[model samples]
Target: MSKHPGPSLAQHPMPWWRSGYLWLIIGLTLAMLAGGVVTVWLASQQPHAPVAAPPSQAEQGGSLEPAMQARNRTSSRNAKALGTGGD
Candidate 1:
């Protein structure tokens, strides 16, 4: 028999914070964090891929130009109709 009676694992359970499993969890967490940082750095270092340019207003025809064109056509048609009916 031992001179000093020490508490055995069977007698008292070690708290989770004092366990080897806790260290493993901490290690895995740090590893994942490091991986994420490295990934972000690598991504930032690379040049961005070219993106398609959006359609421009001038290329699509000016908005004001289209509205003005529509107004002119409607006015000319009404003038012609009124002229023919009144005669």
Candidate 2:
């Protein structure tokens, strides 16, 4: 046999800290990834709020109705003044 001996057993044995910590790092990375996925899912899940409807006729104190009536009256009066139709 050669003069030099083979490597020591302890030198090759896995270090205690590295073994557990490597798994811990893997677990934390997985947890973060899962959390990110859940966050995106939650963000996309919500429905949008509905748009407000326009005010009803009663809310405007009959403003539009009076304007329409005035317009009709003016049209009829103009028609009579022009003598283009019934007196």
Candidate 3:
């Protein structure tokens, strides 16, 4: 009898298309693609309204500039009165 064993034959693996893992990956990819398509279609159908600026129109128009200066002055005066103002 030969000390060496005969070469063992292993069965061939299943094709990628028949693999469950391959199908899972394909299914997930198709799902994500469908979701993206639906999202794009919904977005395209919506109104394209312009977004308005915030409610602080004074900052943009410079109308609140004087009010802000007056507030700063009042705070400085209060700080000096309370002796919390840095020299």
* Residue 51 C-alpha lDDT in model 3: 95
Clashes of 2: 0
lDDT of 3 by residue, 1-87 (tens): 769765554545556688799889999999999999999999889678999878776666758778898889999988999999923
Where in model 2 is the C-alpha error above 4 Å?
A: 1-10, 15-18, 50-87
Instruction: List runs of model 1 lying over 4 Å from the truth.
Output: 1-6, 9-18, 51-87
Tens digit of per-residue lDDT, candidate 1, span 1-87? 659878998899878788888899999999999999999999889678889899888788767788788888888888788885321
Candidate numbers, best TM-score first, in rank order: 3, 1, 2
Highest TM-score: give the candidate number. Answer: 3
User: Could you report the Cα RMSD, in angstroms, for every candidate shown?
Assistant: 10.6, 13.9, 5.9
Instruction: For each candidate, give its TM-score against the true structure.
Output: 0.39, 0.38, 0.51
Pick the winner on TM-score between candidates 1 and 3: 3
Model 2 vs truth, CA RMSD: 13.9
State in Å the error of residue 7, model 2. 9.5
